[model samples]
Target: MSPIRTIVLTLLALLAFAANSVLCRLALNAEQVNPADFTSIRLLSAAFILAIIIVIKDKSAIRHINQHGSYAGALFLFVYAAGFSYAYISLSTATGALILFAAVQFTMLFKGWLAGNKMGNQEYIGLLLSLLGFIYFVFPELEKPSIVGCLLMILAGIAWGMYSLNGAKSTKPLYDTASNFIRLTPIAIIGLIATYFYFGLHISYKGLLYTTASGALASGVGYTLWYQVLPKLKPSIAAVSQLSVPIWAALGGVLLVEEPIELHLAISAAIILGGILLVILAKNKH
Candidate 1:
């Protein structure tokens, strides 16, 4: 693919991912799908779809997971999917995306430090600004937000951060992305099943359809594209691009779910977007 095509495709992938968040929220809040059931079905469906694609396209991809790099990648994916699904039960889609991406940014920064990447002064300043914005956004939500939901989302973000960093480090990028899904599917399924038992929930046909679609399109295909793009993107660019997700998800909520857009949400959006833009600009200077 040409550079322009690659960039466009990457953006498209992000949009699809944002849509996934909206869909998950819709399924949980409207469709009455239990968060745990949704998570389990989505992951299992995604795994099945990807498995079929790999078998048809390249059976050799299966070997990639057994490589050392895949262990960390699979773990990250497992934790991320599980936590993310559980969080949506009580958290607003916009709030959840914002928090998750913000956490991911911090994780990436830590990864950079460990990798001996030199952090420019501007980067540090931008990071501080972004952190403040995140705190501002999350502070009010904590008073009445579900504790279980908040904890799950935070854990999910940590998992995703690790997944992205590991992907950056892996030598076998293609297989790592593909095989990571395959390897993590069984674990994700187990978690989902356990969640079902603990929560005492059942999946309806509508819930299954929505969750499965999210997994197949937004997650399964979307993540494959993401992993393909990750190796090519500068970490800072990747992180900043994710800032758009909250805005998009918020818009989605307003349009689809009719969620109220309070003054604080609007202000928080501006601050977070501004901080992310600053980070991107500062990184460009180097």
Candidate 2:
């Protein structure tokens, strides 16, 4: 791929990832769709789009779906999706994005450490800085995000991180991801059924529209673009590039939802991103 095309695709994919935060906030905050419905529809749409792409790309790949996926992977995906939607009920787009991404990075790094990958001093310092920054960001304050919301988003991030860790071993990432989404169907259905009994299904046309766009455009197509560009980029570059996701999400909140970025958020985001960048650079250093 041309350098220019690669940059454009990378930005597009990042933007798509960021959009999920904004879209979920928009849908849930506005009460257009309940969280349960949003998660179910979003997962279904993403799975459908991804499956179609796989078939179009290679018909034989369809057969691998059953072989590539696991119930555990599907559970992680479901938890992430469901927790993400519910968390957005009380979280601003920027704040939620920040927490989610930070948790994901730290989870991956911490897991690597537990797996016997030794970390340098710089990596440890960076990890500590990021963790402290996260704690300070969510600590009780006048304008702090809801404790419940923060915890749910953290859970969502951890689940997503686990999902990514599993994917790291996959030779066919796209197929594996597609299979995971497909496998999540039964879990989502059960959640929706329980939701109906408890919260009662409440969905609007606009809600359905937003979830579909989120799943199809942002998630399905977005992940496709990311996978296409991932192999061409160096590992460090790919890792650091994701740091922009929260920033883009913050920008999206301002532009798309009129969400304000407060001073606390700015400071915390800087610390978190800076620390994460440090970790990535340290890991890639010779």
Best by TM-score: 2
Compared with the true structure, what per-residue lDDT tens digits does model 2 show for residues 1-286? 7999999998998899899998897788765688888898888899999999899999998986888757787888888888898898888999999989888888887887898989889988898888888877887542655888888999999997887666555666677778878898776678779989999987887778888888888877776677667667775676687788899999999998999999999999988888888889898994
Error of 2 at 93 (Å): 0.3
True-structure RMSD for candidate 2: 2.5
Task: Highest lDDT: give the candidate number.
Answer: 2
Q: Which residue pairs in candidate 1 have backbone atoms (N, alpha carbon, C) closer than 3 angstroms, thus clashing?
A: none
List residue ranges in candidate 2 displaced over 4 A. Answer: 1-8, 58-64, 141-145, 227-234
List where candidate 1 sits over 4 angstroms from the true fold: 59-69, 118-121, 169-174, 192-201
- Tens digits of per-residue lDDT for model 1, 35-122: 7677777877877787778778877765554663467777888789878887988888887887777777777767767988777777
How many angstroms is residue 258 displaced in model 2 relative to the true structure, after the best TM-score fit? 0.7
Model 2: which residue pairs collide? Answer: none
